[model samples]
Each structure stands twice: as C-alpha cells, then as structure tokens.
Target: MRNFIFILTKEIRSYFYSPVAFVVITIFSVLIGYYFYNIFAAFSTISFQAQTDPMVASQYGVLNVTEFVIRPFFGVVSIVMLIMLPMLTMRSFAEEKKTGTIELLLTYPVKDLELVLGKFAGCMGIFAIMLSLSVPCLLLVAFFGDPEWGVIVTGYGGLFLMGGAFISLGLFMSSLTENQIIAAVLSFASLMVLYMVGSSSGFVGEKMGQFLEYVSILSHFETFARGVLDTSDITYYLLFAVFFLFLSMHSLESKRWRA
Candidate 1:
C-alpha cells in the first residue's frame, strides 16, 4: 500500500510537470462551456418561437427545461470525453519505454499490478479534477432552471465509470508502444471500435443486436443518462475496467520476459 501511494504520488507529479495535462484540461473546460452556451441558446430560441406561435407553444409546453438542457449537455460532454481522454492517457507507459526508464522502474520492489493501479489512479484523479471544472456550468443550470439533480448525479456516475474504462484501455495501449502518438492513435481507434459497435444492433438481427448493444459502452451510458441506474450497466463498466486493467498487468508482465 505504501509503495502504491508512492507510485501514485510520483505519477501525479509527472502529470503536473508536463504541459499535456494542463492543455487537455484547458481544452476540455472551454469546449464544455461552449457546449453549454449553445444548448442554452437553442433553448432560448425554442422558448421565443413558442411564444410567437400557439402550435409551437403547445408542442414545447411539455418540454421540461431541466430535461431539455441537462440531458443533451450530458450527452455532448460524454462525446467530449470520448475525444479528450486518449490525449490524457497516451503517455502513461509509452514515455517510460521511450526514455528507457521502464527497465529501471521494473527493478524496484513494486509489483506490476501496483504500478498499473498507481498510474491508473493518477490518471483518474487528474480526470476527476478536469470533470470538476464543469461544475460551474451545472451550477448555472441549477440557478436559472430546476435541473434534475438525480439525473445529473447518475450521468456523472456513468461518465466517471466510462472514463475508467477508457483509461484502462489507454494504459494497455500505452504499454504496447514506445511512441506516444502511436499509443494515442491506437487508444482512439480501439475506443472508436467499442463506441461504434453500439450502432451495429440497428443493422443486425434482433438477438445479435441485443448482444451488440450490451457489449457497447455507450449503451450502458444511455441507461445512466436516463437516470435508470441499472445494476447491469454498473457491472458492465466495472468488468470492462477490470478486464483492461488485467490485460495491462499481463502486458507489463510480458515486458519482464521480453526485457
């Protein structure tokens, strides 16, 4: 436990020492803020149109401000995460390998799983901080409109879990290559595959479609976005994260023999 903490602390410091973490954070905050502004503008436009037209007013009468704004905001944030997380995670193990420091680190008393978990925790910690930067937007929503707090809570929970899965996959990808760009590209490709697989259900037969949706990370996120909070979705994310983490540990173990 002590060793793990030391490693985690080191990894966290590394993130701050480099410009990558700061860059990613800045880009994410700006984009999310812009996204919220767009949503708010669209909502305002809709409200204005409704006031001018009785038909439009009746059609939009059932639109809850909270649901109309917050849900789509969450959806777009999820998409932003899908794009930004790879940049955040690309250098985890790749940099070590590139600098030939991985060999030195492996000689330490630390176990492979400890190293993986320490690094994983460090990345997640950074991501959580980035996610917190969006809080002011949510607060704005709460102040101007009665956003559904329950839905907001569940959506954040889903985002965090989905991020864990992305980090785990990115870590494994980083372990496979010495070039950080290659690592980032591979991670993005892998994530895209997992993401796009969800759409396959629409093209395939019913039985296979259900299976595709079940396997797709986005499908589980949909339930959370709707405030459903099903155990199956929770379990899927847990297992997805664990599976990739285990693969990362195995990948690191292979480095020992290949060294």
Candidate 2:
C-alpha cells in the first residue's frame, strides 16, 4: 500500500512537472467549453421557437432541461474525452521503456499489480480533474433551468467508469511499444472501434447484433446518460478496465523477465 502510494504520487508529479498535463487540460477545457456553448445555444433557440409558435410547442411538448441540454452535453463530453484521453495515457509505459527507465522501475521493491494500479490511479486522478470542468457547465444549466440532479450524477458516474476503461486500454497499448506516437495512435484506434462498433449491429443477424451492441462502450453509456443505473453496465466497465490493467501488468512482467 505504501509503495503504491509512492508510485502514484510520483506519477502524478511527473504529469505536472511536464507540459503534458497543462496542454491536455487546456485543450480539453477549450473543446468542452465550445461544445457546451453550442449545445446551450441550440437549446435556447429551440426554447425560443417553442415559446413563439404553438405548433412548435405542441410538436416538442415541454422541453425537459435534462433531456434537451444535460443529456446531449454528457454525450458530447464523452466524445471529447474519447479524443483527449489518449494524450494522457500514451506515455504511461512507452516513455519509461523509451528512456530505459522500465528496467530501473521494475527493479524497485514493488509488486507488478501495485505498479499498474499506481499508474492507473495517477491517470484517473488527472481524469477526475478534467471531469470537474463539467461542473461549471452543469451549474450554469442549474442557474437558468431545473435539470435532474439524479441524471447528472449518474451521467458523470458513467463517464468516470468509461474513462477508467479508456485509460486502462491505453496503458496496455503503451506497454506494447517504446514510441509514444504509436501508443497514442493505437489507443485512439482501439477506443474509436469500441465506441462505434454498435453502429454495425443493425447490419448483422440478431445474435451477432446483440453481441456487437454489448461490446460497444457507447451502448452501456447510453443507459447511464438516460439516468438509468443498471448494475450490468457498471460491471461491464469494471471488467473492461480490469481486463486491460491485467494485460498491462503482464506486459510489464514479460519485459521484466526479458530484462
């Protein structure tokens, strides 16, 4: 436990000591703020139209702030995180290997699981910080409209789980190569496939389609975005993250043995 904390703290400090964290957070904040503005702007326009036209009001009925704004905002944030998270994870193991520090790191009196967990925790800490950027956006919504707090909580919960899954997969990808660029590319490609796989479900047979949909990260997230907290979705994300962390640990183990 002590060793895990040590490594975790070290990893977090490494991120701040370098420009990576600053750059990622700045880009993410800018992108998320832009999307939030657009989404809110659209919602305002729709609300104005509904107020002006009886037909528009009748067609749309009552515009739930949660549905019209918050839910879509969560969806867009997920997409933005999908694009931004790779930059955070690309150097997890790749930089260590590239700099020949993995040999020294492996020699430390720490268990493989501890090392993996520490790094995972460090990345997650940064992700949590990044996720907090949404709070202001949500507060803005709350100031003007009544959004469902329950839905907001569940949506953020889903995002945190999904982020864990993404970071774990990225760590595994980084462990496979010494080049950060290759690691980032691989992580993005893998995440994109996982995110979009559900779209192809419609073209397939029933069982295969069901399987594809289940495999898609987006499918599980949709339930959370709808304010539905299914244990099955939570379990899927936990397993997804654990499976990749397992792979990353073993990747490091294999390299340790080779060294």
Best by TM-score: 2
* lDDT for 259 (candidate 1): 56
In model 2, the Cα lDDT at residue 52 comes to 91
lDDT of 2: 0.93
lDDT of 1: 0.89
lDDT of 2 by residue, 1-259 (tens): 9989999999999999998998998899899899899989888898999989999899988888899989988998899889999999999999999999988998888899999999999999999999997799999999999999999999999999999999999999999999999999999999999988999999899999999999998789999999999999999999999999999999888865755
Model 1 per-residue lDDT tens digits across residues 90-187: 99999999999998999998999999999999999999999999889989878877878889899899999999999999999999999999999999
The residue pairs found clashing in candidate 1 are none
> Which portions of model 2 miss their true places by more than 4 Å?
none
| Candidate models: Cα lDDT each | 0.89, 0.93
Q: Residue 134 deviation, candidate 1, in Å?
A: 1.0
TM-score, candidate number 1: 0.96
> Which numbered prediction scores highest in lDDT against the true structure?
2
